[model samples]
Target: MQESVQHKGVTHFTIVKILRTFSPDEMNEFEKFLHSPFFNNHSTILRLYKELKKFYPLFSDKCLTKEHLFSVANKGKSYDDQLLRKYLSRITKLAEEYLSILQMRTEGIRKDYNVLLQLSRRNIKEIYTRKIKKVEKRFNNFQQFEAEHILHKHFFSALKYELLNKDNQIKPHNELLVDSINNLLDYFLIVSGWLLNEIESHSYTYDTGSKRNAVVAPIDRNMIVEFVENAISNLHSEDKDRMIFLEMVLNDMKLSSPESGFSAYTNLKKLVYGNSHKMSRQILQFYLQRMNVYCLLENLRGTHDMHLDLFQNYRKLLEENLFGSEGKTNLRFLEFRGILISALKIKEFEWAEKFINENVKYVDEDLQANVFHYGYSLLRFYTQDYSESLSHNSKIQSGLLPITIDSYILKAKIFYVLGHSDSALSLADSFRHFINLNKLISDFHKQNLLNFLKYFRAIIRLKAKNNIAKAGKLLAELQTSSNTREKKWLIEMTEDLLKLK
Candidate 1:
């Protein structure tokens, strides 16, 4: 539609996005769905669907415009503007209906479980019993803690649904049944509490990082944190090996202390490594996700040793064929960044070089340029290829302002290292101005970066004037700052200047 590009492919693109996101198999299934009279009855809608398929992989304006689509859809019949618009509307609804059906079919457990709940509530005894066995079987097939817990939701729901039935002659009040029910309720209470904390934490994380409009949820801050903490403490004696219990512990650590989350991170590693084959793919995926989050947390905290642990963790996930599946780039992209940083942290240039070249191809084309260049630039910089480092990072164009501030700090360091003192000083000044003006950049980050810029500019000045004595005084002042970025690297450079005498 020529209505507005603002809501088009780059943004919303409603029906267009749904169709283009389909896999080859999904597209075929969608075609069958369209042909089935149960989903679509209008001939014009069918014609519209056929016309849209021709623009697959790239639903460009050439064939996607309403004029062309209407012209082709009502070939022999003259196109009535009103009729054409109705045809598009009907076809759009058909596409939406098809997507809903496909999602349920692909993820069938939730649908069947919901139906089981409904059937149990209606006191449809025979069908409810049959569905119960089927649901239990499906739930049992899942080895992930999330699956068990999700099923536990349904399990407890079904138990309550059956319990409420007036037709039930006798209530089974067995100890194991009652105990199991109570435990699941407790586990779910923790899940609910942890979800609340995560929602609140994101509010804080974003509030400190960006100027984006945030919808504040009205809730007590301290109460939820205390609830989750007490829940975890109460549940810790819970089968320690159980996944839901482990997740609650890890999530609490992630929310409260990212650096301290390292211990929780190790516990998750043991669970995955020891029981991956016994676990469902869903649970393995969840474990990998948490591990990566912890990896990032540790990296942000400047914990240097975790660099090697992540290298092995990513390698193991890849070996299991779980790291990147179905051509997804988001996870692979995170792993790429993590591996690159970890490798550079320990100076494993050979492995870093191989990983960068091989893994960049897996990154989505839209993101590869900006994302990989940032990693490659770091690798190049660490390997002493200063020129190429600047060349690669020049194209990085870090998207987030906070990350951009760090990139500028890196660029200044590169310039100084390459003996471009004037450019380095100019860049430091530009960084100071940008940080001062950007209200979006949090005060915490601004102060840290300001400390970096001040000490960095001082070092550049002293080196330029061949004043080693003054450089030492500035380095001591820089060391005293409460928080500073690139502390070790800055100290190393300053010490090098001191050594020249």
Candidate 2:
């Protein structure tokens, strides 16, 4: 049956929005959550839940109208909008509670700490001590020294000190107090360093764009850097704490000065791999990702060639299975593209194909086909299979700004390479207009893409006329210009044009 127009309000309801976000498994879990008497006792809400669930993800059924919902929920009664709203508001609250509960389930250490605090308040000595020992054992067995671990360690140490002090019969252990304080300081220092690094990076990213109105941060970043550096200098390089401090400093260096970015990146990479054994999987992933970002920016700056090195680091990440966190098997779309682009940049066609085929399943189900097609499009283009490349490129849909823009560039390049100059030029004009009109894209990205289109159109027109002299001039202009995206592709195209008789 066609959905009733009257049901539009219900379809666009807030509860419907919340429910649509739930996966099939999450839907089942939410049903179970509602069934719990402690969570929902009203029979009317249960009836409403049954009615609403029938529509599920697409709550557009004609029977899904508000009046129908009212009849189903409160049988043998006249429709009442206020009462229906009340039930909906309650269910929405319950759905929100379920979300919080889901998040809480993932935070095992936080939950344990909460239990420990409550037990201490109740002075449940035996059980609290047992819980402490259990958690301590878990921590001891835990190899991942990520932020959570450090925070939990501090919590455990401080609680241990408090517990000892609570006992009047025993002397307060000064050693435990000292240990707690040190852990606390370590947590502060590590967290502060990372935050400062982000601040330093943000300043470079936003401030350098001429069109962007940069927001000055309130605090002096230099003072924070200075304090962190001074504290880190006291610790040896072998110490895990010192490694994080150095990583943050290097991260700042990579962003602060373009001249020294590559040098900083190399040293930061050494720090990461050198202490890979001592560090947790999460920390390794973090630093590797940071290094990749530096490489990407430096390469985009058109001052360095970090493409192959970035690809190699991605290989290391893939080898170590550091792309996903514990229990998270899905590869993010951006990470998938990052790996694909890095491989394609170095013309590793076979490797790129293998990665796409093997790992496409790890992308979100909805994005699997489009992501696969996009990767293959680039791969085919790099291999000079223009027809096959366009075939794959045409399969790409308008989603994900980066993928959409890349597919546009890919399709235009395929047309250009296959001697379809008119089509390439037409597409370049439309793409230039699209880039200018897009508001979500940053000014920096807009300028870069516009630069790509400008050079792209020139290359196509020059190649079509067989103007070798002008193409040579354009090639030099491109080489000296710093504001271009796809610098490598444009350079190669211009160089190819020069070779044509």
Candidate 3:
């Protein structure tokens, strides 16, 4: 049946147009009819709200008038307190009807809110796992579009609220949610950014007249630098209380250019000095030792001044602490060992010998082996002490301690200086074998080893004075394989050996 409505000058026959033109009192009556039990069903609520909202705005001053209220009320029907209490008559009855059914339908899909609350209170990794599962489920499958939408909207909103709230609902669990959220956000940002970069960069080719094509883009160093700077800036200051945190930061910063490392080290040193706490002092020493070790290993002569200055300050700190009754003895020994190495590098042999002799008793088995081997090599090559050096070398080799290539070169040089041609040749042969076994030789040390071997062989030939052919052959090999610095050293040594011949 068609409905008819009269207007000022027109007659409306459609039901929708009649509702759209209804008076405020009539619209209020329609709203009451919509919320009643007769229209409680989802489809009925939706249909009535759709028709009544067009004219209902004129009847209410509230933002979500009767029409909007009806929409939300229908969604809340099974869960709403008033409806559940009136219809189910008991809380258990309502839970059995609605909560149990939803739980069964979405079992193992949504994370348990209670479990999440507990885990968040403790900052457990299990909480992260549960959150990931919940996020995945919300984003993946959906039996009803509305169900999926509500789940995601509410879940994220609740998570954000929990993370930002400072009050401790759980005892002794302050900032746990904040830390977890930061970690998760960082993980997601790093992974998604990498994936996005990989996807956006495409490799393609087009052929034209038998031509090949290529595409290339230079790496952005500035972006990398900015990322590192921002990362350092954002690290939690509380984490700096731990020794491991300072070590990790220093190691990461060291991966930058040498200039960057020096700058960062200076700033970090100042920070540690300013703090002057026990942990800060330990951290400062750790970074100082690490940076100095790297500089020595890389032979970065440019930073020698900075290295010495820092090492001196670190040694003083260690000494002052170690001499005290309650000081750490092991740390004092480490500082003394580092100073000995630095003195050796700068050819301060007297200081090196004095320090080693004074602290030799406190040195452990590992330090004994390293010190004896290195000290023997130095004494033999630089101080020209044959018997004493040989005694130490025999001890190191008998102990089967690992020897560096530089140590082998120094031993060969010592044998040549002592006129033990056979011993020098054997040492050179062992050095060559070591280099061949370790295929990944550093460019700096490779040249140094080649030059040392060449000089040793040349001296042997000079002593024999008749193996001219063998001598020339060795010199030719040195010239062919040598870098610029090595070639100059080889040429000078060859000239002197030829003159002797």
Better of 1 and 3 by lDDT: 1
Model 1 TM-score?
0.79
Give the runs in model 2 whose Cα sits over 4 Å from its true position: 1-11, 14-37, 50-61, 168-213, 218-225, 236-256, 274-282, 316-333, 358-373, 394-400, 415-440, 450-483, 497-501
Candidate 3 lDDT (Cα, 0 to 1): 0.48
Which of 1 and 2 is ahead in lDDT? 2
Top candidate, metric lDDT: 2
Give the per-residue lDDT of model 2 (tens digit) for 1-501: 334543445866889999988888888888888899999998888788878888888887766788889999988998777898999999999999999998999899889999999999999999999999999898878765566777778888888878877876477687766667656765665566566557655544442444356555554545655655666776665776545645555454445455666676777777677667767676677677767777776677677788998898899899888866655567988789889999998888889999999999999899999998888888988888888888988888857888888888888888887788989989898898888777667666677788888899888888878999999999999998875788988999999988886
Worst 10 residues of 2 by lDDT: 202-211
TM-score of each: 0.79, 0.79, 0.40
Q: What's the candidate order when arranged by decreasing lDDT?
A: 2, 1, 3
Instruction: Give the winner by TM-score: 1 or 3.
Output: 1
Q: Write the per-residue lDDT of candidate 1 for residues 140-259, one digit (tens) a residue.
A: 676555554554554655474454454664655464365466557556544554465566435433335445755554544355546556655665464554534445444544434545
All candidates in order of TM-score, best leading: 2, 1, 3
The local distance difference test score of each candidate is 0.66, 0.79, 0.48
Clashing pairs for model 1 are: none
Q: List the residue pairs that clash in candidate 3.
A: none
Q: Give the per-residue Cα lDDT of candidate 2 at 136.
A: 89
List where candidate 3 sits over 4 angstroms from the true fold.
1-225, 231-279, 300-328, 331-338, 365-384, 397-401, 404-407, 419-422, 438-501
